[model samples]
Target: MSRNGQRGQAAVPPAEFRSYYGRAVLKTPVWEWKIPAYLFTGGLSAGSAMLAAGADLTGRPDLRRTGRLAALGSLVVSTVLLIADLGRPERFHHMLRVAKPSSPMSVGTWILVAYGPGAGVGGLAELVPSGLRRALPGRLLGRMARPAGLAAAAVAPGVASYTAVLLSQTAVPAWHEAHPCLPFVFTGSAAASGGGLGMALTPVAQAGPARRLAVVGALLETAASRMLGRRTGASAEAYSTGRAGRLKSWAEALTAGGAAGTVLARRSRTAAVASGLALLAGSALQRFAVFEAGVASTKDPKYVVVPQRERVDAGIPVRGDDRAPAGGTG
Candidate 1:
């Protein structure tokens, strides 16, 4: 019963919520546009490397060539964006000094280190002049191509999914709440983007696998996206409101349209290219949407407070970890 003798009142969320000195309860992440862009490019690079290996093994030379070059290009962009965001290239190098399995960031650094050389060699091997392949050095490089590309492909899953893990393990409520599906969403987006590139770059006749990949990726992405929207948490509001909501709406439309186009494309090069472009746009938007949502959750104190209050009302234990993350002391 209410103090005024009313009963069964519905809880209404406050119009405004603020923390000490009007500052966010959690520090808004220092990350900016570059971080989200890096996430997309990293996923693209991983997907392309995996596609390249599959294409090469299947004897689809054109698809293999496109996938290899795309992977390398995406990797290069991913590295540059990461470096730019850090404001110091040496920070990345410094992080390489120690390997910690418990830290997603640390594991990601090692994964990149292992995957980079192989992707580099695989892509560069294609650039050798036809006449040079007869030379000893060129022949040696050529011989190294298959193994290098396959090795990179083997490591690509970690590259595609680590960003999701990194974001979720942070203090951000929106990211942490949706951890179960983030990896699936990211990997699916990566595959979709790679398949898009393959379709646009390769001839339609050789693009069968790309088409299949595009459809599968689209389905996985869509399903995981639904799970995110349906998950129980106040933080889920972050994804469905404001700028994030607009971007997510667009992402879903483009992904679905692209998949539909791919399925009906058949031998039409024009349709393949158009659909590929759409998928790429959708994948980029998806990253931005997730990034914006996490940032939004931190900015609004309700995301944290309401959840704890609800848990208390329901007689559920509120979870917490008082331990601060350990430094390089390890």
Candidate 2:
């Protein structure tokens, strides 16, 4: 028997090269700009909800109010973007038909359902008059606000992270391979965006936590992105080349610069505003870069073919037809 276990044949060398009519092995993502926009808005909303819950619990009513309002507004816009991405916006209701733990989309839909009303109630709580708040339903809503906001906060991390999983679950080489790190990267982005909003909208005195959060988030995002790029190896070439690379490069620069600005400009409201805007822009650009990278990965057949061929060469059985042809006597 030969080394490859083929009867009466010498071990065949791997094929030098191959191509399938220069076509893509997988379909590119059909999602539009709405998807990336939804990712940014949803993450920002979730992160803001978490911050609101923290501020409320700590008796920082001003920060709490700012966080709540930000959460509510971002959540509304996020939901609209999500629905717009659907094939038929009206059919979005179908996503709630079952609680499928195996389906990220279903789980995410339910999370949004729970979070939307919770954030809305929390945002509106302080708006009601004292006299009206003492009334029947008003009193009930007032009482529910804290608990609802807390509950939403508890689920907020999942909201921010699930989108990462949603992308990672796909067959896209760049996405599936980076599943372990994508959630962390996205969570960091969410935090930075939420912090940016807080800093931009709140007074300097109340912006302490926002500044701290911005610094921590920026650090986390930068570290995770660098780690992901290093770990993905050749699969990440799509991310490093072409349009995705340009977007990601700008994102990294802006995130780092904004974080530095936030720390240095703590006392300067004008400088802080500029930094906050940069962070927000950076967060959005990161999402767009990831989206574009996944699409690009699918376009190139080598990304799909090479990894599987490597597995086959190593004596591991791949589930699909990924084996490369043997090179004869060359």
Candidate 3:
């Protein structure tokens, strides 16, 4: 009997409406902390590599060395995180076996394979003494440094942006809906993180470019995140309502405060350090927030059903996998 008013009506209506007892529409991702950690470290590495190439071209040896070391260290850490996330470290090697143009993960694996060696060679060149360059091998390595750095720099943007695309490729409502702006948000956060590292590690006199980059990155990240929220519609609620909301709020606050502090602390080393730490923390939190939001979106049946329902009502063809059961509501 229908609970609302009918005394003896059957539960099933004349029109068939079937669902899996409100089960989730998609499988929940099993990715854990390592993935977001990889995103942060990878972005930092890529941004630093790009900075290193620019510094080398501009004759800023100090900045170039800092950038190189940063890139190398972060890239190594990022690779470790990625391998850890694969559950079995050996699985990481399997990723190198194929190149799928349509698969962001496959493409990103190749990009990392290419970027890692270039960045490593460039970093090693910086560490080798000039006197050592008198040796044939050393001289060859030195000569290869600039070109390697340039090559790594060329692929750096892809490293920073591809993770966002990977997330967007998923069926999770929050992630897929924010595709247009996720790359921009992540790229900007990467720039901010790289700049923050530079400001923290380099002397104030040589940190001007880093400061500028941080400011620009902060602005872009903030703006793109806002745009993403707007574009996500109902999915945005997943980001705004729970643990995800708290993390994102913290990310925004820290990013804004850090940018302001960077500007105001032009001469104060202590303030600069504080601001730089804030920016780095903020960037990491943003990645975690995005991950959590996607998870949240997947848990709620409405997030899956509502959109599919709207499409049906509008006479739009739903994907075969997403189609509701015959005459079903969802």
Candidate 4:
């Protein structure tokens, strides 16, 4: 016998890990492309709301106008994308029937509900017709605009980060593994997208906040994404392989290019627009890359089995275990 006499069927390595005839262990997310697009728009809206509030307070009328309008437009787009994904518009309103703080999806629904009005009023404040300037309704809108914008800004963080929670809570191993830094990744992407838009639309003289926001967003996104990619697990490999890897690589490159352009934006309007566009593109790609990674992880068996094996080797009990041991096992 060879060594320990391990032979025959036992020597064959257990007929490979076909848990269910090569089928995915977990059901992949049913979300379509619109879901990822919604992720981008939601972040864009949240970030733009905050930027508008900042611009309003800082006496930058052009920036404020641009931000307000952008927030409103993106919010509308996000709603449409989300509704489309649900396959019915009324399904969205149905989600409003109850509040569940413990549920990320539920919380996100509420956040969007709370976010819309403030953003709408804030943007509408900017679009008052010339003839209506002296009207009481216009005057009321003007008076309510600042408070409404600020409210939206206050809620924007939740708007930007909740999507991360929604993704992480799912069975997708890549996203679950990346939970710790996902919020930062998302919020940073949101900021980058919004700031990029600002840089594109606003002139250099009033674009200081946008420039700073872009830089900050880039920093947070790059750092957090690195953290995500560097995570110690088989699942993280999904982030650096196949189409997901390609998307992430492009995202990183574009984001870096955008960050670099921000440095020279003050000197050239062309640079500002170019940088802004790059950052916006990078943010969208980043979201799509993350979504793809999660979906990819669900397809790859290693993302499921390998992690469990690691836990078992470490004497950690899996889901059904009554008590997970603390010591390593042979």
By TM-score, the best candidate is 4
Better of 3 and 4 by TM-score: 4
Model 3: residue 13 alpha-carbon error in angstroms:
13
- Supply candidate 4's per-residue lDDT for 115: 92
Colliding residue pairs in candidate 2:
none
**TM-scores of the models, in the given order?**
0.91, 0.89, 0.88, 0.92
lDDT of 4 by residue, 233-304 (tens): 787798899988999999889998998899899878999999999999999999999989988988878788
State the lDDT of candidate 3 residue by residue for 1-330, as single tens digits.
Answer: 457776885767654323489777777777778888988999999878888888788887787888899999999999898887676887778878889897777887898888988899898987888789889889988899999999999999999999888788777788887899999999999988888877777777777777888888989989998886788866878888799999999999999988998976589888778888888998999999988998888888777777777788799998765422211110
Task: Report the candidate with higher TM-score, 1 versus 2.
Answer: 1
Candidate 2 lDDT by residue in tens digits, 1-330: 778887884568656535688888777777789888999999999878888888888777787888888888898898888777775776679777889888766777888887788888888886788789889888988899899899889888888888888777778888877788899999999999888888777777777788788888889888988777887755778878888899999999999988989865578888788888888999999999988888888888888788788877899988853311111000
The residue-by-residue lDDT of candidate 1 on 123-174, one tens digit each, is 9988889999999978988899999999999999999999888888777778
Sorting all predicted structures by TM-score, with the top scorer first, yields 4, 1, 2, 3
Error of 2 at 201 (Å): 0.7
lDDT of 2: 0.82
Candidate 3 at 176: error in angstroms? Answer: 1.0
lDDT of 3 at 199: 79
Give the C-alpha miss distance for residue 247 in model 2, angstroms: 0.6
Pitting candidate 2 against candidate 3, the one with the higher lDDT is: 3
Query: All candidates: CA RMSD in angstroms?
Result: 4.0, 6.6, 5.9, 5.7
